[model samples]
Target: MSKADEKYLDIVENILNNGYYDNNRTGIETYKLPHQIMQFDLSKEFPILTTKFVAFKTAVKELLWIYKDQSNDVRKLQAQNVKIWDEWMLEDGTIGKAYGYQVAKFKQIDNLINTLKTDPQSRRMIISLWNIADLKDMSLTPCCYETLWDVENDRLNCMLVQRSGDIPLGVPFNMCQYAVLVHLIAKVTGFKPGLFTHVINNAHIYKNQIEGMKLQLKRRKQAYEAPTLWINPEIKNFYDFTPNDIKLIDYKHHEKIKMEVAV
Candidate 1:
């Protein structure tokens, strides 16, 4: 099993079995443990779940939708059969100028990639999508808000900062998607994938999601090993690539545990 899967499953089991039950702002009372972190060394393996089909293509599409397209439209996601954001889409068919907008507004992607290839030691290599100025305009704030990229020993590393998380509904998808980003960026910028770190400030299982968490935890230990990721060899540009360009070479996983998504 990949260390990523091991670490993630460990956290899932630890929280469900021994985390503190608490209430928070969303009225989505939770079972939360403070400051839980999971890190994967990508030099050894890709950090994707083999225990469950992680929708690697779909996750890549969604990531591109936010960062490349810079679109706030749910219709674009719907066209791709990804409805994960349906609940949070506004009546106007937009989720506000979130995610990709921030990326474009600050010319984030190119700037970061350039910095990574140039002065990688610079601590300012962060791309943030959580715009406090536009929060009220959004149905829901971006979950994977801040990402810091770095280089160590000629390999690319990334750290994703999530301010709030609904573990069952959001965390897993975010983990796989961002890890893919780290891999893709590494490929585009001429470096090997290194480490992927996930930090959740308010990592919680909602009251309604307790049973589901338990169910997932029951199968967590039984999760299969991590799978290999394959991106099209011809695809060099991140923005030009689509769902068709990325794939999971051989994913293996247990039965998926159903869970409610609390908006």
Candidate 2:
């Protein structure tokens, strides 16, 4: 089994058994555990869950929309038949000053890329989306808000810091999205993909989604091995990447476990 399955399922199982029940902003009660962590060696195997179906293309599109396009508009995603951001889109037809807005506001992606090329050993590499002044303007505050980058022995490593994680519905997507981000950045910056670590400050499963979690957990034993992430070698520039430029080869997985996103 892939380390993603082994570790993620372990997290789910542990939360179901020991998580603290609580109420929060979404009004839906949740069983939450604090400070959940998952680490992956990207050079060994891509870390995507195979216990259930994940919309890989959709995840990649969202990632690009945030980093490459640096856009807050949901319509662009809608044009691609991606509606993941619909819930948080404000009246102005955008997600407000969040995600890409933050990335673009400070030229985070360009700075990261430039720094990676010019100074690989710089420890000051960080991208933050949790802007205090703009929080109220945002439809939804950034959950996976910050990423701290590093380079070691020609390998690019990233640590994704998420303030909150909706375990069943959102965590799976975030995990795959960031891993792909690491690979994409590594490719563009002329480095190999290394360790990709995910840190969730609050990892929770909504009360309404417990059965879905239990259902996915049952498939744990039969989880398939991780698939290989293929990137278009010709595209050395990050902005040129689209969902088509990346793919999962031999991706085998069980059926989807539908769950509600606690808005």
- Number of the top-ranking candidate, with TM-score as the measure: 2
171-254: candidate 1 lDDT, tens digit per residue:
778888898888889888888999899998877787787776666666656767777888888877778877777788768876
Sum up the clashes in candidate 2: 0
The predictions' CA RMSDs to the true structure, in order, are 1.7, 0.6
lDDT of 2 by residue, 220-240 (tens): 889999999999999988899
Please, what is the TM-score per model? 0.93, 0.99
Q: After TM-score superposition, what is the CA distance of residue 32 in candidate 2 from its true location, in Å?
A: 0.5
Residue 213, candidate 1: Cα error in Å is 2.3
Residue pairs in candidate 1 whose N, alpha carbon or C atoms collide under 3 angstroms: 50-252, 51-253
* Candidate 1 ranges beyond 4 A from true positions: none
